[model samples]
Target: MAAILVPSLLEVLVLICLVSTCVSSKPTNKIKSLNVIKELNRKGKYIGLITVTATEENAFFATGAFMPHSKHPFVDLAGRRFFVGKVNAAATTQQLLDHFDLKGIIHFGIAGNVNNSMSIGDVTIPKQFADTGLWDWLNPNATWDPSSYVAELDFDNYNEPNFNGSNNLLGHLGYETVQFFSESGDPNTPQPLLWAQVSEDWLQVAATNLEGIELEQCVNSSLCLPEKPKLVVGLSGSTANMFVDNAAYRDFLYKNFNVSSADMESSAVVMTSLSNGLPVIVIRGLSDLAGRQSGVNAYATFGSLAARNTAKAVVQFINNIYSFSSS
Candidate 1:
């Protein structure tokens, strides 16, 4: 009787294991832990510090306020901890989320300034981010079919001598915006969202506290900007995969989206943060005029200065983050 009971119990346990495995096969639509995650719940919440390039990361830590952890990839300053994610591209930004349990994210880097009013080394904190990469190229010689595409750019309109010029190379190029659906929203009835907004509460704190912070105006004695660099808050920024070096496209982005700055990764990072329900903000310093300059692009010359200025603002912003989080 005892032997029979033991076999029955073993069969029951095997059936339960199989059932659990089958049930877990369905997609959870969440980031699964890739490794045995060490629990940091006992330690204080840590914020994420993300940058696009090595130059940006070096400039950020140059502020001298942060102390690197002896063993981990974290930095400590003023009793606050931050996880440094200094990889390039948007996919890495998503990977960071998978690896660490971060309370919030702050992305800082250099960007091309579309706003002609803003000068090099000026830091901008945009209120929201948009992906300007989506587009459909139209046939240049095809008849004007209004139904061909939605929200077309019509490079013909910008065919001034300075833009498309007589060559009309961009006559077929059309620009479009991307539409994203939320994972948390109803699967049966989903809503498409266009813009990924930053944390309003965090933006308010920045607006109130960062206004008085001064920004760098010069790379050196000879390379100084004509005007002082100022911190401009509450503007919109555009993000895409390609580097923007065309004056015509830069003007189009400015006229269409009214974006203060443009970069390669900010939109993706912000969108990921928004999807995870984490507070996120972007700090981008203007390195060039986005081809608005008369000659070659200014990024090569002013990139470091712009990165340093962004770092300066980020350090101050982190110092104030504690108060906002506590409240």
Candidate 2:
């Protein structure tokens, strides 16, 4: 009986060991798969070229060299290497940074043209970017108070053409700007909060170098813009998750924010890059007038054209980035 027990115990112990080894090896294999490869780590400093959607990426790729490897997201482009930040905002921006060391970041996408002076397919490189996603809904009886906590949007005052005030309950919305504490700030103590801004060095370089590059006026030969698309610099840009399709809301944003373009992702990229002490710039193509169009919103018709034009501007910006590095 003792001899039989001993052999049985030995067999059980061996099986247990085998099972533990296999279980531990699984995680090890996973970790190994996730580990950054030698090729990615040795690429040196690369520029981050980010796009918010497949259309934008395809348009950007159309302009020049794009070599993508299965191991990483880095793409070789136009005699330079770039870390491509995939779709969406903060998460994608952080992902690019986590994977590769980048010299600077350039975010490009199609946007609703809040400034009516800008036409569809035109591009704008705003100097300042703000995430206007934070908001407070006020009651009809709420007091009109403006403070650091709340910047009221006076939609009632705008008197937007054809706005049916009888059915409008959106007049009480208030905008709140995001504030950040310094990385060194103590959790228990009060610290001054700050807003993020784009890198002036990069902005200056783009402004000086990419002024007159002709933008695509048409998606195809028959669907040309009424006028040739233009590149405008040094305007303010705002971002929010909500798409602005109401003419009254568009007028409010234009009047209150003084922003030329509005999009879903730019401010997130700007904030993330600024927090990391990296230089960044955003190049946006006006896809449609944010709710200002007389007909059904034109974004469905011209979004691709605007994206193509923005890509052209981004390509030109990349070619001239040496000026930024030198500065």
Off by over 4 Å in 2: 1-34, 69-95, 148-150, 154-171, 182-195
Best by lDDT: 1
Please, what are the lDDT tens digits per residue for candidate 1 over residues 176-218?
A: 5455545676555544445779989878878988976888778
Q: What TM-score would every model get versus the actual structure?
A: 0.75, 0.76
Candidate 2 residue 178 Cα shift, in angstroms, is: 0.5
Question: Tens digit of lDDT per residue, candidate 2, span 124-236?
Answer: 99988766778887765667676745356754665657876453455567777676543344544543322357888778888888889888787787888889999998999
RMSD of each candidate?
13.7, 14.7
- Report every candidate's CA lDDT: 0.64, 0.63
Off by over 4 Å in 1: 1-44, 73-95, 141-150, 158-171, 188-190
